[model samples]
Target: MSIPAALRRRTPRGTPATGRGLRLPVSACVVAAVLLAVVLVPLLVPLDEQAVDMTNKLHAPSLAHPFGTDDVGRDVLLRCVYGLRVSLLVGVVAALTATVIGTAVGAAAGAVGGRTDRMVMRAVDVFSSVPHLLLGIFIVAMFRPGVWPVVISVGLTHWLSTARIVRAELLSLRSRDFVDAAVSGGASRWRVGVRHLLPGVLPQAGLAAVLMVPHAIWHESALSFLGLGLPTHRASLGNMIQDARGTLLAGDWWPTLFPGLFLIVPTLAIASLAGVWRERINPRRRSELML
Candidate 1:
């Protein structure tokens, strides 16, 4: 019999399994560093909003201001740290909101199948047909530009995929022998769903939530860039980039470049970690990739 690809060692059968070792650790380290920056930077380094030196404004990278100064002579490095904090907050909260909404809807639809399932799925399809970014823009447009509005926008627009994942997982769990046994033992639908089905799908749902963080961060950044997210006074990756357009055009690059790096690095690190989790959770999908 042919061994499954996912179970096979990366090298030959006799060799050490080395391919998976580096990625997970490196990604974890990067993510930890980002979280540390988000937590410690604000408390350790204070930024005085009113203290701007026009003579020192827009200085290129130097020993005094490592990441350089912005258009108003504020430290770019400090602002980038603040931006990461805001972006991380928005991403994590929005993802959790989406996960909760999706899990509830999906659990209901899967647990009470038949007409209810059909109706719920139809609703999902209708929502999914619209692009997430466009829908997010519309939702955010209804509220004042701020952190909460952006969070709500990203959460509402991003839950469709999670719902589908959860619904499918619950449906699969519903057909299992344990579920049928519970039903035969006079257990109520709600009891069986809560005790059995919910636990089975939690891992999948958790993975989906983890994967949503990067997308949520990017969404928040995009909205802020468009001036529909956090206000201009707030330190956000999108707001930073938006505020730096003139300087970038004027041939000074650090203002735009450093914030963009901060944004890109975390998203990539989170994505890598998510990939590792996906492979560990779903060996079949990983096997397919090895083919």
Candidate 2:
């Protein structure tokens, strides 16, 4: 229902505490935690994330190979298990880059006002007017193939919407009371902006970061699907899906199905996380936001 009551902070007298207003979505909690676990364990446990075993090809799901094997005999479970690392890594890096660039540009536009805001927003509008995939393709075409290329290209292309969002939020905050108080207290523009305004900006940025993960995941996969992404040796989700695309009609269901399913999990995770954020922000209105 409304931001689960179980998370409500209570005192011995059964009154709500200072933390009472904050809430977390249970589904997001499980999904985010599971994703983190999947990414970390393989790295720490010494299971070679990229070690290929030719003899194990095409084995169906069993005690040993849970998800099954691919056409080349690599353990599908191991690949999926490790593939989360690659996908999440790309998603995290690209999204952070986008957020940082967006935040800086947006902050300056909101803080300076007048010609600066107009110029920055006009630039954002120009970029946003173009198709994201088209820009991504051009970026990929410009660079030689690699993982960083995907990160940089996606990062650059995806920042406009976030920049606009940050700009709008900062605009709203610019005239607020504490902002005025900080200014009246003789705080420098940078200090007041960073200390007072930026703290308020974080919730949106956090939500943006989580929401951006799915976008990054889908973008990377689409790029690889279009043949403009990570090279074979890297073993990204995109490359996995690209490998599976050829086998889809050949009755090689494992290759296609497994990668697709893995991609869906994170998309679902982010959607759920976004929902939780909505609920936590507006407990009574969570259902409206959910749909």
Candidate 3:
């Protein structure tokens, strides 16, 4: 049977079919692998930094130590894996917290749509005016360095963008036929907003949450690097990188290199997945890509 050319999807010039087809799966696998490692690695492998052997400090990468040894003889590979666990934990928790807060605030403001909306949006703008890292630094500085503090700081600082996205989505959805029909059918603003609007925003909220993960991870890493995040006793990508400062300058690169790769790879994979998701959700973009 002959198919219509209009319905046929065409690849962009110079793009490899195999690469395009595999992009999503590869990104999914990378994300899943990182998540699995974060969850299961601790149970399967022991990472005891205190059990360090000074004799092996700053060793280069070898079969016995894939990522080499850190300044204290702790296994770089092990620490990187453990650090990944901490980063992922903070990122996921903070992103979820931000999502919840943002969704609630945005939904309320968008549904009410009056002085209430103006006030809420003004507040969002005020918060957005401050650099997130600076605000995060200020917030974390007030408390002792720990995972929870970083999570709170990151979550509080990151919610503004999500709130804006959610609010815009709600406002757009407000004008839709279903929403108008519900309103015409004697639905109160509260009922219409909650029953009709909230559910409609969940998918966008979810994608926002997913995309926030990498940003949260970087924020936590920045805090840790500045000695304001998780304690030194814990493994963290930022702490690891910070600790490797001297070693990196002294000609040993693996200490800094490996942890960085761990950080960069997972974030990139997540971002790729998020991009795919965004395209899927946007009808115009989806159609453009198809044509």
Candidate 4:
């Protein structure tokens, strides 16, 4: 017995096909490893008792002080790791918060169209009109300058983009035959929205969340750099850069350079992962790649 020509497997002409289905990108792996180290390494390796060592201050990079010392004599390497942790924490929390809010608003607008959609979209437009950085600064300043304030400010300001993305996704999903069938089968709007519509929107929501992380991180850093985010005492990538501003003129570059690299690497890695994810999720892109 032999297989028919029409049923035979067809290899893509100009591309090599692998047996592996979907593999994580190398950039994602590196980003995950870096995040894991940032979160866990500090817990495992005991920090120096005098992380703020005044006597060892301003020492250049050495085996003892790999990232050199800050103006206040704090170990730059230890502080960098801790700062990375803080930044990552803020970014993840803010992104999650935004995603939740966006999903809720988008779902509501999509499930109930006409006047409700118009109202919600108008509100989104209003929020989008304001410069996010200014809005974040104002929000942070209105309350006391602290972690929660920065988290809330960034989270609130960044939701508009996600909301629009999710709304579009849900609107498209709402018109699908399955959704229509579900509605006709005695499923209430709420039930259909939750059971059918929401599930379909999750993938887009997830991609939006991942893409939001880097933006949130940078937003928090900017706020901190401008002295409106985390307090000066707190170790954050933004504050580290802020602390280095004066030192740059004194011919010392390690303080700013190292922290900047620390910030940039993970951000770029996550963004690359997001691009890969976007391609994976887009039907047209997926189909083109498959060929």
lDDT of 1 by residue, 1-291 (tens): 999997764643233446567778888999999999888876776765335778889999999999999988888888888888889999999999999999989988987899999999999999999999999999999999899999999999888999999999999988999998999999997899779988889989999999999999999999999999998887889999999999999999999999999999889999889978877778575575666
Between candidates 1 and 2, the one scoring higher on lDDT is 1
Write the residue-wise lDDT of candidate 3 on 20-62 in tens digits. 6787999999999998887787788765744588999989999
TM-score-based ranking: 3, 1, 4, 2
TM-score, structure 2 vs. true: 0.80
- Candidates 1 and 4 compared by lDDT, better number: 1
Q: What TM-score, over all chains together, does every model reach?
A: 0.89, 0.80, 0.91, 0.87
Residue 48 of model 3, lDDT score: 79
True-structure lDDT of candidate 4: 0.85
Candidate 2 lDDT over residue span 86-125, tens digit each: 6777888999999889888887888789998999899888
Model 1, position 287, has a per-residue lDDT of 70
Instruction: Provide the RMSD of all predictions against the true structure, rounded to 1 decimal.
Output: 3.9, 6.8, 2.7, 4.6
Give model 1's TM-score versus the native structure: 0.89
Clash total of candidate 4: 0
lDDT of 4 by residue, 63-133 (tens): 99888998889888888888888888889999999999998898788767899999999999988999999
Which candidate has the top score in TM-score? 3
Residue pair clashes in candidate 3: none
